[model samples]
Each structure stands twice: as structure tokens, then as C-alpha cells.
Target chain A: METINYQNFRIEAENICVDYNGKVALYDANLRLKPGQICGLVGMNGAGKTTFFNALTGFVNISKGKIRINGESLRSAQKDQTIAYVPQNEGIDSQFPISVWDVVMMGRYGSMNIFRCPRESDVQAVKDAIERVDLTDHLSTPIGNLSGGQRKRTFLARAIAQRASILLLDEPFSGVDIRTEKLISELFIQFKKEGKTILLSTHDMIHVREFCDLVLLINKTVVAYGETSEVFTPENITTTFGGISPDFLFGPES
Target chain B: MELFSFLNLDTFITDPLTHDFMRKALLMSSLVAAVCGFLSSYLTLKGWALMGDAVSHSVMPGVVVAYALGLPFSLGAFIFGVGSVALIGFIKQKSRVKEDTVIGLVFTGFFALGIVLVSKIKSNIDLHSILFGSPLGISLSDVKQTIFISLLVVILLSIFRKDLMLYCFDPRHAKTVGINVFFLHYLLLTCLSLAAVVGLQSVGIILVVAMLITPGATAYLLTDKFDNMTVISVLSAIISSLIGIYVSFWLDLETGGSIVLAQTFIFLFAFLFAPRYGIFKLQKLFAGYK
Candidate 1:
């Protein structure tokens, strides 16, 4: 697979708003993403990164907003299975007594007719995902037994198996070992090369400074949106997290 | 002479009434086992113990309604059970109240209404069958009712097995994968209501809860996979059924009580001694290795 150049909008949000229990979570949040790029959403806790993702994916209702992918609405993308969302945490109960292979196989469900059973191609896709994520060894193991990093990798395997055109990831690097984070970062680069659009949220400065093509910093509002090098200035770092020295962005050692 | 008559083939075989009662009991018991056994796995997975209780108890009003309307009793139980489940789901999702609170609220209110209805029709109706079993009193008509509901339940389950599996395990993920969470949730509740309606006569309210729950919970301790858990649940239910009936026949005990007692034994077995996920298994592993 070859990377497509950034072109027309693959994902767009206009005046998106969401409210939970009468408390506004996200208000008139506007975002746009083009195909074949890796974008990072860097935000403080409760800065509405997840809410925006949920709204774009239709996990929550779109109130007072226009969201579309590839010139079609979010509702239309749902029918086309164009957006594949990987939540902050995987939803399968850890003790559910299911295999790693089975978890990955869940990706194929979107591609299958709901009324019919999953077919052999679905199984093969899952296998390919497992092999790609270097989880061939743990294919038979129950998901509960996996380490935190392995679990994240398994979720990546699910998205890969899904073969979705757009990927929505929420903090994939959280609580993972550096080595595991490195591997996931490499995989995202590979996904970009294959012409898939990725929108991920994170607070990890290293991943942001080195890899992302676009960066959006927020604390309940979009502070900066542009190339990572342009938006990730020393002043911007101190502004996003309160009281942090500009030198802390790279730190004394670096 | 009487003892010899009890032992004689001519006496035993020629008593048509006793033979009929025995056959009816076996058919009815198996039907109860078949439905309750399989349905319990879903109930356990969903953490709806109270909902199951509510469905069973709420159907009391439905039965009363049926008596009042002069319709078939099973139809009444089904309507009330299904309707109440929908109501519970609607309230929980649509309101600020927590789910258990909603279930308790709806079930208690519906059950109270049923009590009032039954009290109104008290003289003409004997609604003991709604609360407890008359297993020895199963009629041919009861068998017909059990068969129809069980068959419908089994067929619907098989058709939706994959969606239901995902729906139970990871509902948000299920939604991501194109399974409508609300639709499947209500569909499963509908199945539970149907099973609850049929299970009323043979297993009674309390025992039906025990049967649907204990077997699946027991199976959870034994297997770490969905397919195996379902299988183990059905197997445990069947074994309990056969032994419960045997124990009842041998000792002249209540059928529902004995079956639940047997299930409790398995629960105790899995609880105390099963491996890996079981308490005993964890203990054994802790003592022996990791």
C-alpha cells in the first residue's frame, strides 16, 4: 500500500457540541482532517479530545454540528464502515474467556452482514492482523493474560484487521513501556504510508515532537493547529500545562 | 398384598392416571431445564440478577390480567414480562435514575399491581403456580405451552448467537462493529421474558432465578471462553435436572427444590474446588506455584 497525498477532507467537524448531565463537555468544537496524514491532538485532562472523537465517530449524537467524511455525512460513513475507532480502553471484558484471535476477529464484524455468520476471510484478516502486530505467539492466549502494552498492540491489530480508511485512536501510548510505544509509533507511520488517515490523542511530548504531521493543543479550546514543529513551540508547551518551564519541553538532559 | 401390588408390572403399568402424571412431569421438567439452562448464561453475563427477578415477579400481574381477560395464562405472563422489561430499559436509559433503582421501582410497582389484580380475582383463581411449582400437577396443556415457548427461544438464540455474544461481551465494541446496542439489549430481554414465562410453572420464581443464575455463574468458574461457558451451563443444567428428578423420586421431595439444591452443589463445587478462576483453583495455584 502506498500513501496518498493530503487532499480533500477525509474528516470534518463544524460547530460540534455535546452535553452530558447538563454539563457541557465540548462546545462548538470544529476540526478538519485530510486523507493520508497523521494528526495528533495534544490536550489537558478533560480538554474534550475524547468527546470530539466520539462526536466524529457518532458514538454520541451530533448536536448543533455538521460532521462529514469524504464529502458524506457521519451517518453515511457509518453505513460505509469508513471510520474505525479505537477507544482509550478496549471494551472486551478482560475475564470474558475469549482468545486474542477472537478479539482481533471482532474487526471483521463491521464488514459482515449482521444477520449472517462470520466467514473464512474474516478469520484470515484477523490472522494477518495478528501477524502484522507481532502477536503470532499470543494468538491463542486469553486477552486477560496480556500485559498493558500487549493489549494496546492487540487493539491496533483489531483496527488493522478492520482495514478501515480512517482510524480514531484515543491515547494509545498511555501506561505503556517505551519499547511498546516505539513499536506502536512505527506501526502508525506504516499506516500513514498506506494512505490511511489517523487522528490520535495523546499527552506524550516525544511522540508529538518527532512523528506527528499536525498538532492541535487544547485545554477546552483549540490553542494551536498546524505542523508539529510550528505548533509545538516552547511557549506553547508551558501554556498547555500550567507552570511548566519552557526548558522542560526538552528538559536539562536533552 | 398392597406392597406386592405396588411392585407388580400389571398394577404399575395398568394405572393410566399415574403413568400419565409421570410422563407429563418428565416432559415438563426437561422443557424447563432446556430453556432455563441456556438462558441463564446470558443473564449471568449481563449482571441482571435483579432484572431476572423482576421479570419473573412482574409476570404475576400479567397472569392476573390473563385471568381477568379470560385469555391463556402464558400469553398474559409473556405480555407483562416483556412489557415491564421494555419499561425498565426505557426508564433506565431515558431518566436520571440508576439502573438497579429503576428495576426495583418498576418491578415492585408492577408486582404490587398484579397483587391487587389477583386479590380482585382471588376467589375464582388459584395463582400459586405463579410463585411456586405444581410439578406433580402438570397437565397436557402445560406441556404444549412449554414446548412452544422453548422452541421459539432456542431458535431465536441460535439465529442471533454471534450478535448476542458480542452484545454481552463488549457492548460498546459491539456498537462499533455495527451491532445496534439498544436493539440487541431489548431482544435479549425479550428472550429472557419468554423463558421466564415458561419457567414459572415447573421451576417457580425463586428456583428459576437460581437455575438461570447458578448454572452460568458456576460455569464461569470452569471455563474462560464464551462457547465453553454456554456448553458447561447447559450441561450443568441437564445434570442437575436428571439428578434432581431422581432424588425427588427416590426420596419423595419437591422437584424444584431438589434441582436447585443440586445446582447449589455444583456452585459449591465450582466455588470451592474448580481450577484457575475458581477460589479453590486460585488457592491451589497460590500454594503450589504462582
Candidate 2:
């Protein structure tokens, strides 16, 4: 394997390929994301958006190629707690007996001792994260009792509390209320200003266009990736989604 | 009225403790119940109730083998309990069979092997006592073993409470935070096996599942916090053990059956009358509409 300098980018993936039991899920995918950029990962259902996110987070093994987070290998970066991943809500068991406070506190577990007893700093970080998400009123409430938007905010707050340089959010907009969407949009801008690299996968084109400075289109591999103005075009959408009506791209008036 | 006779204060509480065997039975059963109850919270949280049942049943063969070899029963039982879990995982991964089906298949097969072994051997190990338990017949060594295993489980669980809870709640998140989720998974399974071995000695194989499930399930209905759930579960189990031991002595019933039955009754009571999540409470909240 040839070595590439990763110092210029916060996240760099070079020709990464992933296969599941002999079937290719992602192939020859390459991406480089600098700090202070919000990248929207756009793809159709089962088109490998999630697969790419999983690869970036080291949740799934890449059969070939390399991934560097902040110029460090994935394992070392993970050890340093450099990445915070907020997965889709479908994977969580909401009926679990956990509180909003408890969920957010988990983000600080990486920094705590083996016993996981939270210190003063950890508690303050969790409180700040929850207040940022506007969930201070529901801190002690069981997660199961929260509404859909509030639940989404709870997980977002967890990612916030993690204090990682890279935030990977999978489908953050789905099943969330308009207020949650607005809050998340605002949070993304703030994160960008803080020089954090944010990559989020979403099916909502309007959200992608509104919140992301860069866009990545995938259909089993990287189809197009660049400035949202130049790459998230109808032609690229057609190429990535395979002949979808143009009206859906820009809404009914288009 | 006949049943109420056993509830007399002397027979129910005072006289039972006067006998040495009754006192030992109470101690042994209470210790076993406390640990099982504590672990039951995790088992229910992880949705591993069936897994508990599978491990408990699978340990039967190990107990039989231990008896045949004149070895400590817990060692053999622990081996079989963990072996069954591994076997189930293996079969589920290797074939198209669902995990529940694999669990059911493995446990039943292992249990049948144990029954066969017991039948073939001419040892003094009674199948009746093995199936339903003999709390009153517990030897001093059995008491020491139960205490040692329970303390080990409780200490280890307390130390890793947060990590194990995170692993049970969201394994993906646990991994992202650099937690060794694979090790936690095996650690939890090992604890479950140890709990099973202890339950096997006190409640026997058949009713041990109840000891390992009911306290936690009942507490789950009564509380919304894991810490409170654990405390409630342990207290309920301890109370039920005492009541069950007293009832068994006063009514001349099977000790293990009475203990499990007592736990079931508590679960039923909580299901009907719990403050927030009970069926009757919900019904009463809407009574004005009708």
C-alpha cells in the first residue's frame, strides 16, 4: 500500500472498499473532508450511504484501502475519542429504562475511569450538551416518554457531549419535527464555525442543500462529490438515483 | 381457610426458624434469590429472558456429569451453561436457523442428554431433587459455594455496571466510544452462567428460570430507572424467598416450587397494582369517560 499524506484533511479515505460475505457493499470509495465543512452524504435507499458512514466510523471493516481521521489511523483516532457517531433511531430501543441525562452521560464514558463514575467536568459537559439541545426540562425523564423530535435531540446532545472533532450523523432528519430540523441546522453551522468536520446522511434534498456546504452522491461508490452548488444538480441526481423525475429534486414548482 | 392456617404467626415466621434445617434453607434460598434477582434486571433489559431459560436448562447435563465424576456440581454446570450459549451462537451463525430456534434446540437437546445420563447412572443423585431442588437438604459446602458465587457476581456487576449497561443498551455506541463490546458480551454471558449454576443448586433446573426472570420483570413494571429496578428486584426476591421457605415448611410443599410461586404472585400483584405502569391504574385513569 502506498502512503498518502493525510495532514491536509480532517478525514481522508483513499480507495476504501467494503464487502459483506462476498457481496460488495461499497467499492473504491474516496473522500477527503477538511475541518469546518458540513458534508451531506446523499444516496438512494440501499445505495451505500450507510455503508460509507459505517466504514468511516470503523463499524464495518474495509476490505481494501485506508481511512485516516485527523491524519491518524482509524483505530488510534477511535482510541483518542476523535469521532462521535449518532446512528439512526431505528437501531435504538426506546423502551429501555434510560433517562435523557443518562444517555448524554454515555458520551463522556470514553474519558472516565473504568468504573465510569462521572466527575464534575463530565456532569457539566452533559448539562451543557442537553441545554444546547433545549432538553434541560426533560433531563430526568425516561427516554421512552419523550416525543420523536425530543428523542432525536437527546441523541444529538450525546454527540455534542462527546466533544469529538468529527461528527457522523446517520439520517438525522427523518421522523423529526420542523423545530428539530431547525435546531440541527443551527447546530451544524455552529459546529462548522468550531472547525468540526460534520458528515451526515439524509434523504431530504432540501435539508442537504440548506445545511451542507459540500455534498457526496453515492451509488455503491462515489458518484459525485464537491461543492453543493456544483455537485447536487439534477443531472447528478439522475445519475445517482437512476432516472428519478426531475420535479422531485427541486420540488413541485421545478 | 385451610391455606390461611399456614399464615399463623408462629407457623409462618417463628416456628419455622426454630429448626436448624429450616434456618439453613432460608439462608441458602435467600442468597440465591438475591443474586438471581439482581442479574434478572440485566437479563430483562437485554431481552435475554429466553437466554436465561436456555442456560439454566442446559446445565442439567453438567450437573449429572459432575455427580458421576464426584466433582463439584457448580463447575460442571458452569461449563455446560457457557457451552450451550456458545453452541447456540455457533449454530445461529453457521446456519439459516433463527437465534431463538437455535437456543430452544440446544437447551432441549442438552437437557435430554442430562436426563439420559441420570437414568443410566446408578448414583445417589435423585432426579426429583435435581429437578425441583432440596433447599432443606442443602449441605454446608453448597451454602459456601452459593455465597462465594453470589458475592463474585455482585462485585463484578457493580464494578462494570455502567459499561455493561451501555453495552446492553446500544452496542454500536459502546464500540464507537472504544469499549471492548466483545469482551463485555462474553463477560455478561459468563455472569449469566454463574448465576445459572447458583440457581440450579437452590431452585433446581426447572424453576430456576422463574427465579432468574420474575423478580426483574416485576420490578420493571414498578420502576423506570435501572438502579431502582435492581434494588426493587433484589428486595422482592429476598422477601419472596423468606415467605416461600416459611410457606413450604408450614404447608409441607416443595421448597423450590413454593419460592418460584411466591415470586410469580409478586409479579402478578405488581402487574395489577403498580403505581404508573399497572393495568388497573391505566383502567382507572379512564374510568370517568365510561
Candidate 3:
């Protein structure tokens, strides 16, 4: 494979392959995301979207691939806090005795001292992130007391506070309210304006069409990827979803 | 009126301190309880109550080995406690068996080995003292050992409280931001082992798990903040230790059993009467709706 100029892209994955105990989860997956692009990762269930995200964050070892974030190795990029990840909502212990402010403050933990005592700048960043998510009223509330949408916003706030150049979100819209959806959409537009790279996985075709400028379809590997207008065709959707053109895609494209 | 005479202020509070052994037991138990209370918050929050039980029981073989080698009992107990944790993790990862099953298997095996060693050996290692504790007969050396271990555990836990909290609460997030999850995992296990060794001196192997669980569980029901939970847990545990020591002295009861009973009673009280999360409060709130 030819070596691409890593400086031109915020995230670069070349022939990424992941194997879980000899079972192939992702194979020969390749993607290059430039700054200021919102790439929608569209795939079916068990299609390795989460696996790809895990690979990017260095959570899972890549069996055969080179991944560079902002022209550096994944570990160096993570150390520099170049990427922020908002994982799906299922794994978090909501009943944990933590406030929304504390959860958001976790975003700044990398910048804090060994004791994690927040500096003035860290506190200000946490406040700004919470404000961006419009969760100021519930800042001090225990995370368990929040509604589902509020809980999603709290994690989003943590990601926003990270102030990283690249953002990776896994199904950020699942099970959230309409108000939260609108709020998140607005944030995405603002994030793009700020020239931050974003890669989000979602099942909602409407959200893909409306918000994503670039679309990458995958079924264990990259099926197609390009500008949304060109790549997000019915054929691509059908191929990605294993031969079924989802009903949502047939809806009038706005 | 005569039934309440045991509660006389001087006889209950002042009499026990006069005896050198009673004073040492009181001080050692309180120190052990305070450290256990502090760790309980993390243990309960991480859902490691069973893990605590496993580590405590696993230390028995180490204690016996240390005795046979003429070594410090805490050293042997600490090694086995940490070893069992690592062994459990290894087995759980290398095989398909669930974590709880692995923990149960490994701890019981180590405990049974300790029992077998006790029967086979001819040393002065009193099985009763090791199992039920010898708080009433605590030596000065035991007092110093408990103080040193408690201070060490308390200092490390205080310094890393927030980092440990983040690790326990959202380890995935902790990893994404560059926190060393593996190091923190082992660090917590090591601290738990240290806490278990300290607990062994006061509550013995059988009841140390209670010292490491009930106070934290009670405080968890009482608060919505980790900081507050630690404080409440420490206070409750210390109070229980002091009260149990006093009552045991006056009533001629087993000291370790009495302390654990005091902890259990407090936990029950919190379960029924905690301001927001209490069972009765939730019941009352539901009744209002009906």
C-alpha cells in the first residue's frame, strides 16, 4: 500500500483488521477523515462499527493496520488529547454517586494534576461544556436522577469539554428525546464550523442525510465511502444492511 | 431500671480503658474499622463485596505459611490476598467461566488449603484466634502493625480517591483520556489486600468482610456523593467499633462478633430510615400517590 500524506487527514486507518480470539470482527477496513468533516459510519448490527471506534481509541489491538491520528501514532495522539470519545450509554453505571458536573469534569482529567484537582481553566471548560449541552440546571444533580436525554447530554458535555480536534461518537442519538436530537444537531454544525473532525455511527438514515457531509458504509469492512450525495445511494444502503433497503431510506430525502 | 444498669457511663466507657489489653484492642479495632470504612465506599460502589470476601478468605493460607516460616502474618496474608485476585483475573480471562464463579472457586480452595495446613502442622498458631480474631488479647506489636497499615492505606486512598472514583465509575472514559486502567486495577487490588490484612487483626478472616462491606453499604444508602459516603462510612464504622468494644467488655461477649453485630444493626437502621433512599421513605412516597 502507498503511504498517504498523514498531515492532510485528522484520522487515517489503512487496512485495519481486528480479530477477537481468531474470529474476524473487522477486516481490511480503511478510512481517511479530513478536518471539518462529519462522516456518518453506517452499518448493520454486528457490523464492527463499535469495533472500528474501539480500534481508533486504542481500546482494541489492531491485528494488521496502521492508524494515525493527526499525523501521530494512536498512543501519542491519545496522550496529546487529540481525540474525544462518547461511548454508547449502556455501560455507564447511572446509579454511581456522581453529579453531572463531576461527569463533565472527567473530560478535563487529562489536563489536571495527578490528584485531579481542577484548575481554574478546567472548571471554566467544564462549565462551558455543560452550558453547550444546555444542562446548567442539572449540573449538581446526581446522574441517576436525570432522564434518558439528560444522561446522554451529560456524556456529550464530557466530550465537548475535552476540546479535542477529533470526536468519535457511537450511536449518540439512540433513545434520546427530540429536543436532545435538535440540540445535538446544532452542536454538530457548530463543531464543523470550528474545523473539528467527527465520526459518528448511527442507524437513523434521516440523521445521516441531514447532518453528515460524508458517509462511510461498512459491513465488516468498508463497503463504500465518499461525499454523502454520491455514496449514500439505495444500492450502498442495501449492500451495507445485507440486501435489505431499509424503509427509512425510501422516505423522501430532504 | 435494673436491666439498664449495664449502660452506666463510668462502668461502660471508663472501665475498659484501664486494662492495658483492653486499651490496645480498642485502639486497634477503631483504627482497623476506620480504614475498612474508607475502603468500603470503593468496594461497594465497584460491586466488589464478594471480591472483598474472597480476598479475606484467601489470606488464611498465607497466614499459615507465614507462621510456619516464622514471618510476619500480615506479610504472608497480603501476598496470598493479592495472589488470589490476580489468579482469579487470569482464570476469568483465559477461560469462559464467569468472574463470580472463578472468585468463589479460588477463594474457597485457598481457604480449605489453609484449614488443612492448620490440621497437619504442630505450631502454636491458634486456629480460633486466626478465625475469630484475638482483639481482646491484642499485643503492642499488633497495635503498631495495625496503625502502620491503616495509615498507609488511608494515605494512598486519600491521594488517589478521585482517580480511583473515575476508574470505577467509567473506566472506558478513563482509558480514552490516557489514565492507565491496568495500573489502577492492580493498585486497587493491592490496596484491598492491605486493607484485608489490617481487618484480619480486628475482625478475623470470617468477619473482616463485614467490616469491609456493611459500613460502606450503609453509607451508600445514606448519601448521593462519594466524598460524603466515605465520611459517613468511616464515622459509622468507628462508632460501631467503639460501641462493640464497650458492650463486649461489659457483657462478656465475643468482641469481633459484637463489632460486626453493631455494624449490621447500623446498616439495618440506615436501610429503613435513610432520608431519601430509605425503604420506608420510598414506601411513604408511593403511599402518597395512591
Clashes of each: 1, 0, 0
| Model 3, span B79-189: residue lDDT tens | 999999989988987888888999999999999999999988869889998898888887767677788888999999998899899888987777778888888888788
Q: TM-score of predicted model 3?
A: 0.93
Q: Write the per-residue lDDT of candidate 1 for residues A160-191, one digit (tens) a residue.
A: 88888899888888877777788888888788
Can you list each candidate's DockQ? 0.46, 0.68, 0.66
Q: Which stretches of candidate 3 lie over 4 Å from their true place?
A: A1-7, A248-254, B1-4, B282-290
Superposed Cα deviation of residue A76, candidate 1 (Å): 3.1
DockQ of 2: 0.68
Rank candidates by lDDT, best first: 3, 2, 1
Chain A vs native chain A, TM-score per candidate: 0.90, 0.94, 0.94
A1-254 in candidate 3: lDDT tens per residue? Answer: 22334349889999999998678999999999987889999998899999999899888889998999877898888777778888777868888999999999999997788999989999999999999999999989999899888999999999889888789999989989999999999999999877888999998888889999899999999999999999998888989988986655467544
**Which lDDT tens digits does candidate 1 get at residues B1-290?**
75445355565544433666766776677677778878888888878778888898788888778877878888988888988888987887788999889999998888898878878776566666666676768767777888888899988888887788777776656665556777888888888888887777766765677877888899888887878988899889878876676566556788878878999998898988887766667667767875
**Tens digit per residue, CA lDDT, model 2, B132-212:** 888888898888888999999999888988899898898877788788888999989988999988887667899888988
Which window of ten consecutive residues has the lowest lDDT sum in model 1 chain A? A245-254
List the global CA lDDT of all models: 0.78, 0.89, 0.89
TM-score of each: 0.89, 0.93, 0.93
